[model samples]
Target: MNNDKKIRRSRNRLIAGVCAGIAEYFKINPWVIRGLFIILLLIPHIQFVTICIYVVLLAILPAPKGSFFENFRAHFGEQGRAASAEHKQRSTSTSNRRIIKDVREHDIH
Candidate 1:
């Protein structure tokens, strides 16, 4: 029921919705942005440089916080949130093994 014009999160995008979000914002076809980038990439002099700059800008520019990552992640499965949480838990536990070991030792008393 969400009537917002935000880009569909289920669709793959180049960079955190930079192309899709803008297209949605302007009510234009997102493919146009993709095509423009492709054309820019085909340019001889500044293709690589332009793409890099666009990527950098996309990463730095905030796009409604979890709006970008979560939306993209949702496409994976119904358990996307749970999977992400479990992955985070595993990573943190591995990284904090020393701290966990110390706490366990103290608790042995």
Candidate 2:
């Protein structure tokens, strides 16, 4: 719930959440992000470079509270505020929290 660091989306991850996280940051679809990444890779040896960049970004980026893309949607003024607030709530909630959902489900068995 820290306003300073943007959390990446853990629920969405095709490739380390790099494309999905960036898409969420920019309020775009993860598919679009993945497409752009693929296009970027098509250019000569950029694939390796892009992979490296993705890896580095993934390691450096923080996971978003719920849907990683929600944070970026906050830039749109009113909607952004609402989305940010919703994300904060989902992130900070005592129950059904994203990170804990896994643990809770595990305990259910």
Candidate 3:
């Protein structure tokens, strides 16, 4: 396993991406890490320590570039772009039709 890869915070984060980053680094499921964290918090007198560690991780780990949703959209490649373009075209066409209708109604008055 390569240890040199910098552990950056994940964009797909509910809280701070600490668990996600650790899961990604270790090739494990993020839920498992999150569960472990919750379990750790439940231990007697460990809640404070667990919170401190989480905060420390948040402070130390660098955040990954771009947001999770952006990355997810990027993965869809051309299909995502095409959908966005088509939506914009439809919006403009609808607006143009509305404007033309309003003008025709005004001219009849």
Candidate 4:
């Protein structure tokens, strides 16, 4: 569990990770934070303020390592990244990539 008080953006962000980071810091589900934000955003008077705060937090919070391009090319999302980081620090000697004889784009179910 996250024990530190410092809040940083989560890599599994839907948008900018502001809500996810806050929820992570507090050890709560990210949806709760997102839901509250949505509720606040629906209010006529608070819409602008809510958006501004979210933008500010988005700008202030730091993104995790691996540049944007690297992450774009990454095979996994936040959960995979975190699990690999904590449990598997290095690639095993036997690790290797499997080559596919055929490749095509189609709908996956």
Question: In model 3, which runs have C-alpha deviations exceeding 4 angstroms?
Answer: 67-109
Q: Given candidate 2, what's the lDDT at residue 33?
A: 78
lDDT of 3 by residue, 39-104 (tens): 999998999999999999988877786866446646786788898999899887855664434443
**Model 2: lowest-lDDT 10 consecutive positions:** 97-106
Evaluated at residue 102, the lDDT of candidate 2 is 44
TM per candidate comes to: 0.44, 0.49, 0.57, 0.57
lDDT of 1 at 66: 58
Off by over 4 Å in 1: 1-15, 68-109
Query: 85, model 2: CA deviation in Å?
Result: 38
Cα lDDT tens digits, model 4, 4-85, are: 5678788768987889988888899999999999999999999999999999998787665575833753645676888878
lDDT of each: 0.65, 0.72, 0.83, 0.80
Q: Poorest 10 consecutive residues of model 4 by lDDT?
A: 88-97
Looking at model 2, residue 16 earns an lDDT score of 66
Error of 4 at 23 (Å): 0.6
Ranking by lDDT: 3, 4, 2, 1
Which scores higher on lDDT, 3 or 4?
3
Q: CA shift at 35, candidate 3, in angstroms?
A: 0.7
Candidate 4 or 2, higher lDDT: 4
